[model samples]
Target: MRNFEVNGINCVNCANSIKNALSDEFGEIVVDLEKNPRVVSLNIDDKDLQKFTDELDDLGFKLIREI
Candidate 1:
């Protein structure tokens, strides 16, 4: 799994949208809007990271960094 700090996630609905968007492609997605840095965790192969980033970007959210 990878942890990514995200921005522009305003509410639970936004978080749920993101989770739904990526759920099919990447299993076990966790969107923690209540976290200090607002993190998203997912279990996906490294090769798919860019695609995941793109998907998030298209959803009007930015993935700040991976940890």
Candidate 2:
């Protein structure tokens, strides 16, 4: 799985929003609440990377960078 650091994620609900909104297209997303700023792990094609970031932004999450 590829991991990306993200902001605006604090609790389960925030994590769920990501899964609900992104899983179908991007595959399973694992959100690590234990980390400050949080990290979301998932498998995504490089071709879809831009779309993935766009979708996350639409859900109020900002993809800071890959970790």
Number of the top candidate by lDDT?
2
Sequence-dependent TM-score of model 1: 0.91
Compared with the true structure, what per-residue lDDT tens digits does model 1 show for residues 26-53? 8888988778568999887879999999
Model 2: which ten-residue window has the lowest total lDDT?
20-29
TM-score of every candidate = 0.91, 0.96
Off by over 4 Å in 1: none
Query: Residue 38 in candidate 2 has what lDDT?
Result: 98
| Cα lDDT of model 2 by residue, 1-67, tens digit | 9999999998999999999988988888999999988999998889999999999999899999998
